[model samples]
Target: MYMKLKCFICGYEVYGDPLTNTQCPRCRGILAVHYTNPVFKIDSRGKGVWRYSSLLPDVGERISLGEGLTPINNVGEIYVKNERFNPTGSYADRSSAIITSVLKVRNIDTFTILYEEDFTKSLTHYTHFVGLKPSISIPRIDLVDLDDILFFISRGIDIVFDNKPLNTLVIKYLNPLTVEGLKTIAFENYESRIPVERVVVPCETGLLALSILKGFKELKERNVDVDYEVVAVSIKNRGCQLLNNVREVKVVEVGDREVFEALREAYEKGFKTKPLSALSLYIAENIGKSLAVVTMGFKTVTSRESAVKKLILEILSQGKPMTAYEIWKTKPIYTLRAVYKAIKDMENKKEICFEIVSKGRRKIKVYRLC
Candidate 1:
């Protein structure tokens, strides 16, 4: 028995090797990481996340960088661990490095392929630094002629996958290290400050939040005076909304069609955004179906204008709603008249149902799904 894992939902503990086991039998929830050694310490002098190697899965010649000890800064109520400071940048590398390292030690000879561009680069950089060759399977690697990405993957890169995985195992294997790496941040936070009142994490697949939860649990076991709630912020996208809803996590759907717009903007601006979740949020909101709120009182944050724009664009792009607009007062490049004009044009084409139900002296245009 090297590592111990516990169920996130039922709190059932399993004492065994981590390489073979996957799920919790008690509640069928995914098993979370738990080291057998609670008081394990690492050489802080070492470079990279490997400094905390004692807390990770047992592996040979662990991969690393000057990864951990990320700066903890406060933003209003949020305490950000500025994961952007990681060596490969972004916190994903921390997890990828650990997963790749463990697989390498197991002699799995596994290659990693990420669906995202920046992530692929991060994976390659860290894996190579750890003496493993990784590859990238660019979804559009061929659609757009690449200068460097092409040469790298062609040269026996260890991993790359662009089209989102239909298989959950691919996601799980590729992501084991991320959960492991993210745990370190929580450790540092608990040791540095009073446990947070709440943690707001930008969740793509819920792994980050899951890891945070596991890390905090570890702290609590050690008698750390830590108290906090985990809030996994999800988009109004399809895939994520469904998963989050099913998992019973609070899902906040903001914006209209602007949901997708925010995603596109984030992608174009080189920020991380999960479109699937955003799409799910949109569909759920329109249908008036929602998941339970995890806590009695909590605040949901979203940009209404951006969400509405995303909703409108999704409708127009799908050729279902004809057109859309912003009737509410807000700041954006799109003005009130532009919204109305676009709506009128689309209504004339019968691309949408244009109805103005009167609210006192004011009239509101409502577009129905066609």
Candidate 2:
């Protein structure tokens, strides 16, 4: 093996057959992938996370759904790394890709997983693609999200409570491969057009926060010009144990109320996000020059709609709201009917919104950039 699993804490190395568990049973430390000749170069010919395959594990075959290379959007003074663009609509696709690729190379046919809403859903998608059967076991159904239940039911995924099935690997969130998958986010940020200073991520088990920090640390250790601080936001006091020993991260505890308020603010600003990620958004707003990593959103990121819609956005973006007739006047080349049609399309997509203005006894509608 060109790469060996090394303890993230003790630096103990394991060679030969790779272990499934990321936690070192000997030192009781977390494990990470350490390559013999680790390089930090992006292959432009490759797409998505595979571009950083130099820094990633040496899987025989890479099972990818074009996860990673998510957009770093500038919203006000903060930057947003939207991970919802992944094939599974979650950042877990990164881990799922690596996990399934490893399983395929090892010729493993099936696996059992502890049900985590986003991760399980994402894993199922990849498992289905790779022709692997996976059964999920839930710790508590009542505690599970309704959307997750429906998602499984809709996909006809198996839900078995107590069948282990011999020789099947039980996937865990703490796996070293999982970190190898998620740490690519830090690589993406480092390769961003605009330099990133601090990264704010929502913490559940502290795996994600640490994975990203390790990525930046690896870059710095390799003599790459990169400097980044990671901030882990947790709800109340949940999942602060793994982070307690890590001095590289700044842990922030937020209440449920603040998270919801931030969620509302996120939607209002057209950045729909989950409650866990809302904490990062809230924290990023309070700080300066930070990138908030949001795992998913209520909608997909904006794409080019049409030429007229693009022009209309430019006009409304530079100034106040304008009526459709006024917008047509700015670009007379486009017919009045075309401008009106573009406004309707943009309105449907929520790219632009409108408000009514009262002039004398008449009411006129004006469109503004959302």
**Top of the candidates by TM-score:** 2
TM-scores for every predicted model:
0.56, 0.78
Clashing pairs in 2: none
Model 2 whole-model lDDT (C-alpha atoms): 0.80
lDDT of 2 by residue, 40-101 (tens): 88898766678888888888888888888888788768998888889988999999988888
Q: After superposition, how far is residue 240 of candidate 2 from its true place, in Å?
A: 3.5
Enumerate clash totals for all models, in the order shown.
Answer: 49, 0
List ranges where model 2 is wrong by over 4 Å: 1-3, 16-19, 162-167, 298-370
Worst 10 residues of 2 by lDDT: 297-306
lDDT score at residue 41, model 2, on the 0-100 scale: 81
